[model samples]
Target: MHREIGPLRALANGVFCLGLLGLAGFGAVQVAGKNWQVQDTYHLSAAFDSISGLEPGGRVFVQGVDAGVVEAIVPPSTPGDPVRLTLRIDARLRPLIRTDAEARIVTQGVVGARVVEIRPGSAEAEILPDGGVIASEKPLELADLMQKASAALERLDTVAGSAEEGLAEVNAIASAIRGGEGTLGRLLTDDEPVNRLVQLTDRGEQTLADIQDNLDALKNTWPISRYFTRRGYDDRDLALYRPNASRKSMTISESDLFDPGRAVLTKAGREQLNSVAEWTKEHLTKKTEVVIASFTDNSLDDLMAERLTQQQAEAIREYLVDNHGIDSAGWFRSRTVAAVGFGRHRPRMISAEPQGTSPDRRVEIILFTPQAAS
Candidate 1:
């Protein structure tokens, strides 16, 4: 053995050493990436509702810096208990890991490897003790999204079924009429009978129209108009009245609201409107509507009365919405804040002689509710 080594033997020895060196280097690199330089690892525990896809040996970062590794996940000791995970953080960084640190399982990149990230708490906080239970945030799970989607689909299916049933009923009624099954069908099918029926309907309609006209006339009668003014029917059919449709009303006189012929509201009017705003916010539901109607006297004739009333209504609307935050949407849900001017005379209210200079030239704020909630 002491004799001179052969050239082939020496070459084989060199290759063997290089192979050993390469293997060691590869293993060291893997260990370093996994444990972040592999110093003494202090174990910290945390609880999560769900970790998503976290696994052992996954890298852990504190404040986005390389810090530790995930060690183990312990199944709940009791039912309903959160899953506990043991985290091995670098001992040197222990001081930086405060008791208030929160751990969250997250992906390195979108669709990349998963890791545990610790939120470094305030520097003034006390250091977390060894084996301390840290707080954790659960990552969003696909199962949760799927559950919500399923619930929404169930609701949509119910609506679709109801709509289909409604359509079917409508079709059945349409088909029955087309087959001359009802009185309406006969009117459409038999010419002589239909003709007689048409005449009867015409007569009946004319009779009702005449009655309506007469009622309109009586509605303008002197003392009766006073009651009508108090009750804002606005051409409603007394036969089919629902008292609950309109809940309440507040009337502000034109004299109190505006100065003489000006359309602008006076300071006192603003104060009155502010009170209305407070009442609406406190008592009115989101589905209630506000109706503002204006009236003028017959002293200015038809056209001028209508125009002045319209302008006054507009002015009141601008103040309520611009200054008080009333809605401008529609007839429903705090909407369609209607403003109508009838000049100095509202026939239904000022029967014999118009309230040419009196409080009839006023705006009424009416609250209309669809139906009272049970």
Candidate 2:
């Protein structure tokens, strides 16, 4: 205005401020498309038992998508129940339906447009509320799945006519095992035990090729060639009764029954007398020890400086042979000494000095034995 300011009037005031910044960016996308089409609403009801093709503007689904609409069907003020509908939906899916939400009335394809879905239930429940109702869903349509597939094809045609009469009694037992009659029709008409098993497999392959040509002529003959030389002086003495319990298949009585001072035993002295008769039949029950006298200490440092015990020295050798009478009953002798040991541990002292220990040492009996338990 301070005069000319020309340049085509400053390019028409910069095209009117670029058309007011494209009309304020087309009025801010038309006020953000009416504030993103303002959704947030709720309502939901349902009931139904037969809302015959649900109406009031229909479309309210949830899992099948749509999400809102059917605002009112009516007739459910409770008389004989069922018919409610209501819906309105979309409050951002009122926290996904719940309080046992169910709804139904579905349809849409066999002629489309029936709607009302809803579904979504257990989010640990409690969301429902704004008009609540729900609970309807019986579904299973396609004319009730073709009347349950025509009663499961009439129980699979009565189990395929009892498996075609059990396959016509297994085709009359395979035509009685192919006409012969049974036992596979006498083994398919036996040929005298199939020609006696083909003449016993050809006389057992000619008696196994004549016993391999008589063991290849007894491997070139003689004891079959001195069977280990002159049958070792012919069972010397019948191999001392048991050289392979020989009845004379000898070798000088199996070499004087393995002599090493041969009175005959030597199979390593009959396996060391059968391991000493299996350790004398595992120690055939012998137990008697009972002597135990101690404290007169023949030094193991005076039997551990006197801790003598073998049942307190056999209760002081039966109190010195029955109450101090000491006749050394059969030379009584007991001694178990080990003053200190260490490796297999030691310190087990028990004394008896003729059962002494009372004098004022505070009650000390000490006789313990009962541990023989192997």
Candidate 3:
């Protein structure tokens, strides 16, 4: 074989050797790129609830740019404490890292290696110290997601079973009705039950009308007429009464009067109302009318907020009229008290506070006096 020693064979052999060298150089460059060591780097740390897949030597990115490497991972000394990670970042990027910067563990791509992503804080934020701990967002774990999905599926199964049972019961009831086996079934099958129900409804309505008529006659009677007039029990509607001017106003926080998410007043609420009662007694005049309005900021829907505020206003009015014996009738022989709920609408600014940050959950009591005689 050595006797030939042709030029073509020698040329082919040289080409193969050069190709091998080129491949080796390419591999070395790749390995070095993966494990590049930063020079004059500074250390920062972060604590996470869970760092399921990240490990030391993992890349750290700042705002999606390759910035550094994770130096080490330290397990908590106590069982329930978070896992801490130390990061070694290039000194060049130190100014960009801020005190409010956040670190989160994220996968590079689907099924790819995990890396730490740092979201740089705003420019106005103070620079983070070299060794300061950056705030960490808990990593989303595939296992936890699977567990939640399984739980949701189980709940769906339970709901399906309940629906099946309910449908079966409904079918049975329908069958019974068709066969005229029970009271409801008989009512459906016969006409007498329907007629009886109609008669009963008519009788109830007639009874209510008679009661109202007798009450009206009693109000006009001589002995009780004076008391009824003083109480403002007349044909005039309170809805028509309107105030010409507001003389004074007092505002109280909703928390001071009612418990959270309820219209019912507490003992402290009663005490607070007692103070309002005293204030009213001192300032109330024959020509003045009282109006209580409530507002709320927490409700997502306007209608619900309105209902809640209305109930709260009613509760306050009830306390003032029944408990404190505050007169609700004016000298003009008309109702002088009104309660309204504005909900989140027409919000009052408290102490020059901005609307966005103002305390919207509050009750306002205003005294309306007739326009001064010109």
Candidate 4:
């Protein structure tokens, strides 16, 4: 081994050794470069319920293009808090990343390393600032899916068993009926049961008719008759007709249109009525009816209060019909004008003031329009 060698042979061996060292150095540089922070990059973060296999140094993609890398993963201080991921992204993508952009953990190809995938938000959204957190979609876990599938199968099995039991019970009942072994079976087999059922139905119809007749007669009787008249139930046409549910209304305070304790409209009240007439002319249709409801805040007895409010409501109706030429006849020749009085018994309004405050005496003019026929 110590024997002298040729110079040419020695020089060739030295060259081969140098080549091997260079190759090793090149590989070392390549390995370190994977974790190196590239220049001209910006930082961003996202929160996820679970990162699962995603880790630091993972690549980040935007719409299938390589755009950045995951710089760090911060575990939550609390057990239930989300896992946070810091990302180092190319500065060129800064304008494309929006506040609404969503991030998710995904794998590249089958059996490849996990990476972060960002879905760029709509152009109308504001751009996300550096170091800002982006929205994250929870990563789907294979284990969780499997557990849910197993639970679904268990429920299906239970349902199938119950269905089988129900089928057996149904078959047993069918067999009993076929054998004429129960009351239902007997009723199906005999004609007397059918005849008896028909007779019972006839009797029930007669009883209902008698009850209806009694109610009609009661509606026409003494004290009750007055109540029905006030409610507009005395008119058979109005009682049977169903109006459309939608309506428009205008309210004016009693003091605005009338003097205290008087149902007569003041001069200002006439002006207010003229304005209401203009509004009604714009919105009124042939199928629409007018309703005038008046309320009073006076301390008069119920009878006197009723009379006063009635007079007030009638006055407004008369002025609209006589002065503005509003029609009194509505759809199908029915009386479209309805005037009602609630003396000291004000119905609730949509724009009512707070409770514990006494409301002003007011008048409400409402237009009830029928729905268009199909």
lDDT of 2 by residue, 1-374 (tens): 47778899899999999999999998988764443334677676767667666677767777666777776677867677777767777777688788887777767765576776777887688888787777887753556655654555565455556555545655665676678764855655877645755655565565556555555444334324334222221222221222121111101111222232122334553444344334333322222112221122233343342343222323322332343333222222322111111111122331322233322111111222223435
The sequence of per-residue lDDT tens digits that candidate 3 reaches over residues 54-103 is 99999999966788899899999998999999998878889889998999
Give all candidate RMSDs, comma-separated.
23.7, 43.9, 26.1, 29.7
Error of 2 at 173 (Å): 2.5
Clash count list over all predictions? 10, 17, 0, 0
- Tens-digit lDDT track for model 1 on 83-129? 88888888888988888888888777546888888887777789999
In TM-score terms, candidate 1 sits at: 0.36
Q: Is candidate 1 or 3 superior in lDDT?
A: 3
lDDT, each prediction:
0.70, 0.48, 0.75, 0.74
Comparing 2 and 4 by TM-score, which wins? 4
Error of 2 at 323 (Å): 92
At residue 153, what lDDT does model 4 achieve?
A: 51
As a TM-score, model 4 comes out at 0.39
Q: What lDDT does candidate 1 reach at residue 361? A: 66
2 versus 3: better lDDT goes to: 3
Q: What local lDDT score does residue 122 receive in model 4, on the 0 to 100 scale?
A: 80
